[model samples]
Structures are given as structure tokens and as C-alpha cells.
Target: MADLRPQAMIFVTEYIRNGNNATQAAIAAGYSERTASSQGSRLLKSVEVQQFLNKTEQNLNKDLRVMFADHAVNAFNVLLEVMNDPEAQHKDKLVAARDLLDRAGYKPTDKVVADVNTEGTIQIVFSDKMKKADSS
Candidate 1:
């Protein structure tokens, strides 16, 4: 993942990190603007380029552990505040509650099974909730 690349490729990597846009990165790396989209798409699919970007992101995430921890805690705290605040908007509170439930491993599809008859053919099942959340 750390294999060395040409200077233009290096420049393109930095551009991609900054904007997360391959076409813009290609243009910023001095490629022809007219062909930037196609060139960028091609460059993004290159093994070396992918490795460089993936390694860079992995390294950055490794270095940002403490920052990520703080953000996670702050975000959860905000969610809890929203969930508990009666003055908060109903939609906001519902979102917070849903998030908390999700984090707690509660899902609409959580199931319970029981046998209502001596025969194996009869089964009873109950879902955590009848309503399934829209994944999208």
C-alpha cells in the first residue's frame, strides 16, 4: 500500500483526499481537463492508486483514535439529551430513541419462537415490533 508512485499520482492522491472527487483530483494533478472524468475514473481503479488511498485513510484513522472516541461520546450524549428533552421536536426525539435502540442491539426483526403444539409443525413467533424500520 505504501509503494512509491509518480509525482502526478501523488498529487492526485492528495487532491482526492481533500475533495473526495476523482475528476477534480485528475485535473488538479495536471491531467487534461477535457479528459479528466475518464482519466480520473481510470486512475481511481488503478491498484497502486487504490492502495495508496486506502493506506492513507487507514493511517489517518489510526492516528485519530482519540478524536474519534471523543466525537462518538459527544454524539451519543447529544442523542440522549434529545431523547430525554420533552421540549425537543417529536421527530428529533424519535430519531434519537431509534438511534439509541439501534446501538443497544434492538431491532424490529428480533424474534422469539415457541411451540404451541406437541407436533413440530406448529410454531409461534413474535417480532420485537411489528413495524420494520426503513433501511434507506
Candidate 2:
């Protein structure tokens, strides 16, 4: 990515922090309110800006995955505690057990319902090649 001006960098940071509100990000980054919307749109169209945003997003996702993994063990332990505690409310225990089972990939099967409104006859035909192969 090309070097970005300080204001542009601020705009990018604010853009993400503000949930992709370009106009708000621009104003927060010191662009005039009158031109912030247009400036934000133009910046978003820049190749360098787009690259920076994508890289930032990828990094954020990586960080989030790491964070989730770090907490997963503790979360599972909490669920187990709740499930095993005799003093825990039955409903709460059931909920925790369900959550643990879900996280462990033992979720209940989903049933699909289909309504058929057409009737059709079924027929089977054998080709000459099939008949010859069968005889052989």
C-alpha cells in the first residue's frame, strides 16, 4: 500500500471504528462536514485506501479468532460447571448442557418438510446396450 497522509490514516481508523460510516469518519478525521461525504467516497475508491482497509479487516478477523480460542476453554469449563452443579437451576443446567452439546457438534438434527402437489407416473426403460451387457 502507498503511504497515506496522517488525516487519511485517521480517516481509515475512524471508518472502521465507526462501523463503515464514511461521512462520520471523514468528519472525525477533520474533513469539513460540507465535503466529508464526497471525500469519504473518494478515499474509499482509492486503490491504496481499499488495500489498507482490507488488510485491516483481515488483521481484525485474525485477532478475533485468537481471542475466541483463548476464551473457549474457559467458556467450556463454565458450561461444564453449570451442567454438573446440583444447586444450579434445572433450566439453567439444561441450557448449559445444550450449549455444550451444540459446541461439541452434537446439535439435534433439523427436520425438513416438503409439500408435493403434483402426481407423475414412473417408468423404466432399458437401452439395447444395457440389454446386451446384461446378457453378457
Clashes within 3 Å, all models in order: 0, 0
For model 2, what is the alpha-carbon lDDT of residue 18? 96
lDDT of 2 by residue, 1-136 (tens): 7687888888899999999999999999999999999999999998888888889899999999999999999999999999999999978998899899999999965423334334754445566666677799
Error of 2 at 68 (Å): 1.6
The residue-by-residue lDDT of candidate 1 on 1-136, one tens digit each, is 4554575466556565767787778777787889988877887888887777777777778879978887989989999999999899978997899898888888655555656565658676655463344232
Reference-based lDDT, each prediction: 0.75, 0.89
Cα RMSDs, all models: 11.0, 11.8
CA shift of 65, model 2, Å: 1.4
TM-scores of all candidate predictions against the true structure: 0.46, 0.76
Looking at candidate 2, the ten consecutive residues that score lowest on lDDT are 109-118
Please list all clashing residue pairs in model 2, or write none if there are none.
none
